[model samples]
Target: MSASDIRAEARRVLGICDACGYCNGFCDLFEAARRRSALTDADLAHLANLCHACRNCFQACQYAPPHVFAVNVPRTLARMRHQSYLDHVWPQTFAPLLNHPVATVIGVTLGAILLLFALVLAFAPAGGGLAIETGATAGAFYRVLPWTLMVGLGVLPLGWSALAIGLGWRRYWGLTRPRRATTGEARRRWCAWRTTLADILNLRNLRGGGVGCNDLDARFSPWRRWLHQTLLGGLGLSFAATLAATFYHHGLGLQAPYPLLSPPVLLGTLGGIALMIASLGLGWLEWRTAPEPIASESRRLDQAFLGLLLAVAGSGLALLLWRATPAMASLLVVHLGTVLAFFMLLPYSKFVHAGYRAIALRCESLDPVSID
Candidate 1:
């Protein structure tokens, strides 16, 4: 599309942004402005940067008073995304799936099924016995516990990786099928990648710093971006801890009930708790004070996803506090299941915003002037 079209679309989106903000206070971007008594073009730029296009704000706005502005931030930020691409800072590599609606749904569905199967088998007792004969030491009830885990967790994840790799290869560089994307679609796909990076990773378009009540506390000091940095730190630490534990136990022959102070268990618990709080608190603010009548329009999918996340955190905490075996295992499984659901249902959920935001940022870098 030409710059004129992009501008018209953007203005239309801005109108939606304003309307939603007016009714719902969902537009934290403008909320920040309202708090500071200043909403300038510069603030808009800052807001743009902070916007990962998660659509939570927009979704909340849709549920707001004036439904006129269904400003799909993803499309609204396309112009900036167009610019990010030329800068070679795209977050995700995109292809036909960027535009292929059916592909996204199917891919996510298959992924979920693959994982669920693993979970079922892992949980289920073996065909003939509760205790499958293992070549391990005597008194080791090792037969069922870890073996089930290996087949269910380890094997299934492997299958998922294989499926993704094979499908990606066949779809992109495969021998059987070659993609045929029109030039216009191709450009948009590239734009998607750009926006995904800038909007999601960098969160370049959050609308504002924070409302008055939140601003003073949200210090943008050299230490960090409140939600962003805390989140990243937590995720990084948690993932590392998970990997370490998985390797030591699953790979090198260690066991569960690793000391609570163990690296992986402790770190993962800490990280998980921190992320749980950050995600829940910030996300709650997004929904709760989400600008009145607008907030009511929250979608089931978004609510369910975030709620699932909250539940996972709660379950983890419960495990620690109560330390009930059945409850702990069940909650852990639920946490795993929800996380699996997230990845499996990825393309179909708002979480897709993460990848798309990065892509959008790259697109913006490619052509800012071209947008208008």
Candidate 2:
């Protein structure tokens, strides 16, 4: 069935599971679901984002497939999570990203890189090839491609990504209909918020309720959790590196090509290492994961995003190692290309999972669980 059918199908499945209350402790999704009398489209969407696809409930369920209930929380929620991207994407025309998956990302990234190289060749001074070295000093990157051109190309897509995520968040938060709380309820919710924050940070749900998640089968493993955290840590560190570089340029009057011990170099080195490790590890996990419980359609998308991340991290690290040599010029172009592509696709890709899941966790925090 098409993605549009997700809401209806999920409603049916969740309706049955909610009544049974058999899988209440499987993860936060079931716990959140238990508090509600009826699951609406918005509620299901929020709940779907909260799911980590640990597959505990799917394995534990007695009414799966052959039974009339046919409750598959992981599969149904995965589809709904994907549909959220389609429904909330910016510029509407670009929403087709959900259809093309991996090919589009790879093609766009490569094309952008080639176009940039062409531009560099066309605009460089006579007898200079991308890199220009003055008498005793190192060849600074800006001499190859000026800051104006770099920022001009980057700002547009980055701005659009920020706008799209902001709008998508507004749409998602509006749908959840978080209630206004009294002081007593607010206090309890504040405590719940602390708990939810910890869960999100640690990905407690992927721990298979404690032992670990079922990656390929009923067997539990924490490898997926560690790999994902590594990716998260890498992304954060890379951003910090960029921010440090920006401050060095604008605030401190220092320029590009800082020392190895400097903030930018140190942060970028650590971040790049983490990113490479996580991207490769996650790509391997995706390759080995079975198609049964997990959503099959997301496989290509996941791989494409991970591929771009790997390219970015690898190229950045290479640029660092070869900065003193002639190779830095080409490495810079490759890194910029991959990074631009990643920022452009962030809103439409699986990258949005972090933001959407955070919103879902906040909503679940405010929700009160009733006891008999």
Candidate 3:
């Protein structure tokens, strides 16, 4: 759909929703909408990102579907949210990949893995990089993949993803008037910042105000919130593990393949398990629940992202478990390749949602009524 069409539909839904305050306490989207007289571009973008697609409002709405109002807030806001991703994505030229992202992600990831595998095979050391056991040691991994190439693979893709995400976030923030223009404005924005940050960290709206979200059916449950927390916590821990490893390697001059009792190994092992479980759980939850309003395209994008996360976690664990065997060499390549793929796709995938949502929350916090 075109941008203008999305904006029009969003405005129509917002107008109807504004008149009926039944869903005012369901989520941040509704609460923010309640404070607005009409929907502007900024208002729509903020409201769209605030939505978590829990489908609570749809289940609770009296004027839903069969009625004339036909107010499907979740579905409407989801499409608008997708549009925002496309609009704010950096490089602008690659934004079309958001249309059906699974193909692009799969193709790019496989190609990178294959290319890395070929390079490893072609440039093996005199004893050979593959088909030989490196044994368990501090610098065993480098015997398979050179430390320079491995580090380059790790750093370059992450740097690119960070830059792209930063650019996209800046653009989105501009749409929402992200900065304070005056002294009072600065204080108000600061207040909003605190409110928004607290709400995001706790995922306050995921609880459907007080009750839980309408996750599986009309009945409310906190399973979705719990699962989301698991996912975020796992991801955060995994990132911390990487940082710890980086510090060990650079600051302390430690080498590869730390022992199981070490901080990096323990953190990564637990994180991998968490990520794997959360990815699987989220996929199951999406399958079991009713996503009537969430578009097929958006669901596909979500699946693609979950697929990448699973690949990263699965391969990481596999490598860790069998690092001393001949299989370690190939496993290292697969693991690093998947990591590279994850970073390269980060800006265009569901990962971008975090940045967009953070900006939206910042905008919402600026409203005086949004406090607490």
lDDT for each residue of candidate 3 in 25-90, tens digit (9 for 90 to 100):
777776677776557777788788888877888898888887898888888889999989998999
Poorest lDDT segment (10 consecutive residues) of candidate 2: 130-139
> How are the candidates ranked when ordered by TM-score, highest leading?
3, 2, 1
Predicted candidate 1 versus true structure: per-residue lDDT over 1-372, tens digit per residue: 553454455555656555556523433334433332232333233334335433444433453325454455544544433322211221134422333434454454346545544654566455311323321222122232344563365456446544544343232212111123335666766765565554555444443323212212222222123555566666687779868877867687786545577787788788878778767755665554424212121233344445545554665566555442334434344445555544444333334334333332443443322221
- Cα lDDT, all candidates: 0.44, 0.79, 0.82
Q: How does each model score on TM-score?
A: 0.51, 0.91, 0.94
For candidate 2, give the lDDT of residue 126: 58
lDDT tens per residue, model 2, 257-331:
888999988999999999999999989888887666677666766888888889889988888887777776787
lDDT of 1: 0.44
Say which prediction, candidate 1 or candidate 3, comes out ahead on lDDT.
3
lDDT of 3: 0.82
lDDT of 3 at 112: 80
Query: Residue 191 deviation, candidate 3, in Å?
Result: 3.7
Give the RMSD in angstroms, all C-alphas superposed, for model 3: 2.4
The deviation in Å at residue 306 for candidate 1 is: 1.3
TM-score of structure candidate 3: 0.94
Query: Candidate 1, 80: how far from true, in Å?
Result: 14
- What are the clashing pairs of model 3? 192-365
